[model samples]
Target chain A: MGKVINGLDIESLSSLLDEARKNKELVQKISKWYARVRWAGTGFTFNSYVRNHSFTISEPSELGGPDKGPNAVEYVISALGACYLTGFILNATKRGVNIKNLEIALEGEIDNILVFLGISNEGHPGYRKVIAKAYVEADCDEKTLKEIWEETVRTSPVGNTLARNVEIVPQLSLIK
Target chain B: MATVVNGIKLEDFNALHEELKRNAEFVSKIHKWNARIRWAGSGFNFTSYVRNHKFTISEPSDIGGADSGPSAHELILTALGACYSTGFIYNATKRNIQIKNFEVAIEGEIDDILVFFGLSDKGHPGYKKIVVKAYVEADADEKTIKEIWEAAVKGSPVGNTLQRGVEIVPQVSLVRK
Candidate 1:
């Protein structure tokens, strides 16, 4: 029913159209919920304000961010996991599945220094490779759960971000 | 205002012991706040550690926190925003919104120099005021997405901390333990 790559049935290219349409709508909704405020000072004193209810985003560490604060690249990984988990949960709930617990773990590798230096776009350390494992506690059959999980990823936000190429044109403002 | 330690005012460092008996939490909070001292030596060498509950500083100074540490106050904001962001993501994921990403950019105000000097002022060194903006991108319509975000923020751990003045108590652990 689909293109087979290394014995794995890959999604048809036609599916990308629906994915793009849904992504466009989702991006707009996410944008409206987003906001930021400056801490008003130098690099050491720079501050920003955000509400938890808005879109999930963090500024760069060079701009007075706590090293604990997720950098732009880290945020990308977080987004994929979050989107996948959320998608799974919604689908499970709709099916009246009695899920006691759900967890998603993701490990990704990227070239941190190369991208930072702007030397090679070829290996921009942007999740060069990612592996995700989902753990679910449910009463459904394995076959049914597997199908649902696959469907969820196909429609999840983070998965789409990784599968598609996005162009980001950020505008910078100087501190007054 | 000079907070009293035991029977003496906080200004009199020696008297702080006396005031410690009367109001322990207040005294403790002060002790935690002043855990680190900055001296003009080779450069800006920090001697303090702000943990989940207390302020800590070692005699040698180079412990968990070094020159790269976020000032004692920055930790407070970090904890608030990080806590809120983490909580919001957990909740949103459980709700099944296909939320792809979560980040918190927090800004705080500490315009007063008194905070730096450790004076007893109405504003806390922790954060006079803080603003946290969260961005959540999901695969849902605008209305549904907004509702999920609202629910996540209102119920997040960090959001709760910011809404209320979380208690800050200082404690120490034995290395031998």
Candidate 2:
């Protein structure tokens, strides 16, 4: 794990960024991000630890949870939306576009658990579609901004997973 | 706010398992999730609002912001990992497996922001693959536990997107407010 350092160590990260810019293939820096969740008998909520941070996730009371925190579904939207926004920031910065302000909204629709319940195979239980809108403020004209946005869809990994077609393979490990 | 009332409480969510076993389509319920994020300046940090859950995410100090919270990338993994764990617990409880302890860990590899930096377009900047491990302590044998694990994967919504594929659509707007 990298030290917390003096904030974001943009110097080191940028040096890495510079190296990546020079060596196209060198940019293929492989990284592992981790998240851990433990479920104790606490109102059906899980204490999740991620990158030295801990938070709680619980379903609605209708589902028998204490409703103390956001549900898993809410987190999904947060991830996708934030990922998309990050792309914009990265691109605008690289392009030298000064962003005065920026905001993004993300929404996804998924059937409640029909597939999860194994009762309905007619539609995907996961998000059938995700819609995201990024409201950006920058000095660039709309035409240039649109171009940046287009580039973002291609560059943003999280949004790309949703914007265009990509492949994700999942392997599960079980310990008894 | 729905009163913190107790009704049809599944007593450890086992009620869900029985429902799934009886009728598969019983899962046809639908819900929408929403979030709004804003970035004003410094560190590319973003403040997010979701169902009254307020938080901020900033770039590592290296990049600028105060490192207020985990990067978006970290949150992505957290969402996936937590969702998968939820699936396992739901499945195990449904299977009547008495879980002594339960936990899950998720790890994935994402290409550096070279692509976003306009450095390289040779590869996908997102995760190439996700590896998940569940440490489950239950009264059942390994075989039964394995079965429950499979069941969880088969039903996990987050895992399904990674295992299968889902479409994400994005729209961009320029607004002052």
Candidate 3:
């Protein structure tokens, strides 16, 4: 049996990496992800679905919600944190480093929420800054771990998406 | 129970809005949202925490995960959709437009999955484009509803975050197990 680190099959992962390294066509493909949200018939609450998973999203009572689940802004930061962790683990494993533990704490700050509340439109409503702190326990030197982390952030899909501008096409269909 | 519109407490929302307008310091202060993620015991699975809520995150079997929950990319779209929905409902309620039904479908296209797989570094790994389709059934004119939809997309925090550039600061630390 092959060795396992952080519950990852190292032999299998290495094989997959080797295959991709040689197969240009396999690495050139694009992927599409989708999600849907529907109002849950109560106080700023929504049911969101992605693949086979679904979760409730709600605002706090201060925002007039029933506090069913985390708000959308919170979800954004959570997604970023999770994405970073994925990148870190994958890179560390690929580099032959065994990770003992990993955790990412994220904080996202919006420039001005008043724009979202429609009280003021002077400033942008989006997040102006995001800070991610990674706590890692691994079997590698600090230098190697830091390099992996830097590469992970640079190549992270979610990280890049948030750090740069993405084209958004909006379409609306009205049902009378 | 104050009168509800589009599942929102109109009276409460309006009062809060009014308060914010009058309170400059409160509006000027930056609001920070927090989330934490810890590696789960299995393959590519994580436990994500936001406030008091928590959920699982994992990849599909092909990508070395058990498919226990949605991937991080999917969560991004979910966040966008939810944010758009919230913006729409709040705007509609403010405009007194009665909504019978509302849904937001989001599709995001990654430029290349190879970048995420660490297979190739030729192209950007981020989403090249995101398409959002909003379906609304409301007791208002088409023009009005369309305007509200546009406003929602424009005002959505998550939507704007994706459409604009943001700063990301990374801090790394090695911990003793």
Candidate 4:
């Protein structure tokens, strides 16, 4: 059995890296992700599905929802934290660092809710900033861990997506 | 009885909106959200906590995970769809349009997965583009419904978050064993 650190199979990860390095086609391929959501016939509540998994997305009681689950914005922040942690662990394992424990806490601040509520259009209704704090306990030096963290953030998919302006195409089909 | 449109309590939503308009402090104050993730001591699996709820996050089996749950990218797309759907319903309800059915489908294309795996840095590992399709059956006209959809897209929190750049501050605390 190969070395396992922080619940990651380093040997398997390394072999995948090697395979990608050898096959240029693999590196050139693009991966696609999808999700579907339907209104659950309630106040600001939705049922979201991705692959074989499903979950509830709803607002708090203050926002006219049953508070069944976390709001969509909260899910976004959670997804960001999860993506960053995954990247960090993978990078650390690849570097042969044994991580004892790891956790990432994230906070996202929306710029304006007034715009979303249609009360005003002074500013965009989106996250103005997102902050992430990573607490890592590992058998490695602080400097090395910081370097790995930087690399993880730099290469993180969700991190890059949020940090940059990407294209969003919206299509609408009305049923009369 | 209070007015209910598209399953939304119009009286309550309008009351909240009026209150916000009266109190600019509420509108001006930033709305902050939080989430925390902890490694599950397995292959790229995590337990994510948001508010009082918890769920699992994992990669596909092909990527060294047990495929117990959806990947982070998938979650992002789902979040976007949910946000857009909420925005749509909210707007439609406010306009007094009765929606019979509504759905939002989200698709995102990654620039390159190799960058995420640390195999290559040819391009960014983030999504290159995202496409959202909304299917709605409503009592409103086509043009009006289209306008509402556009407004919803523009006002969507997750949509705007994905459409524009946001500041990300990262910090690390090293815990010595």
List per-model TM-scores for chain B. 0.51, 0.78, 0.93, 0.94
| TM-scores for every predicted model | 0.38, 0.81, 0.95, 0.95
Candidate 1 lDDT score at position B38:
20
How far residue A35's Cα lies from its native spot in candidate 3, in Å, is: 0.9
DockQ of each: 0.01, 0.46, 0.78, 0.78
> Which pairs, if any, clash in model 4?
none
Compose the digit string of candidate 3's lDDT tens values, residues B67-95.
89988988898999999999998889889
Stretches off by above 4 angstroms in model 3 are A18-30, B24-30
Candidate 4 chain B: 10-residue stretch with minimal lDDT: B23-32
Taking the tens digit of each residue's C-alpha lDDT, what string does model 4 give over B1-177? 988888777888788878878876665543888889998876688999987889999887766777888888888888888988998988888888888899988999998888888777898999989998999987789988988898899899998899899899999999776
Sort all candidates by TM-score, best to worst. 4, 3, 2, 1
Stretches of candidate 2 off by over 4 Å are A1-16, A22-30, A162-176, B1-29, B61-65, B111-113
Q: Model 4, range A98-150, lDDT digits (tens) per residue?
A: 87888999999888887888877877889999999999988889889989999
Listed per model, the TM-scores of chain A against the true chain A are 0.63, 0.76, 0.91, 0.92
Compared with the true structure, what per-residue lDDT tens digits does model 3 show for residues A25-114?
645433788999998865688999887899999987666788889999888888888899998889887777888889999999899898
| lDDT for each residue of candidate 2 in A37-110, tens digit (9 for 90 to 100) | 88755335788887657888777654556676777767777777777677777666656677787788888777
Q: How many residue pairs clash in model 3?
A: 0
Q: Return the TM-score for chain B, candidate 4.
A: 0.94
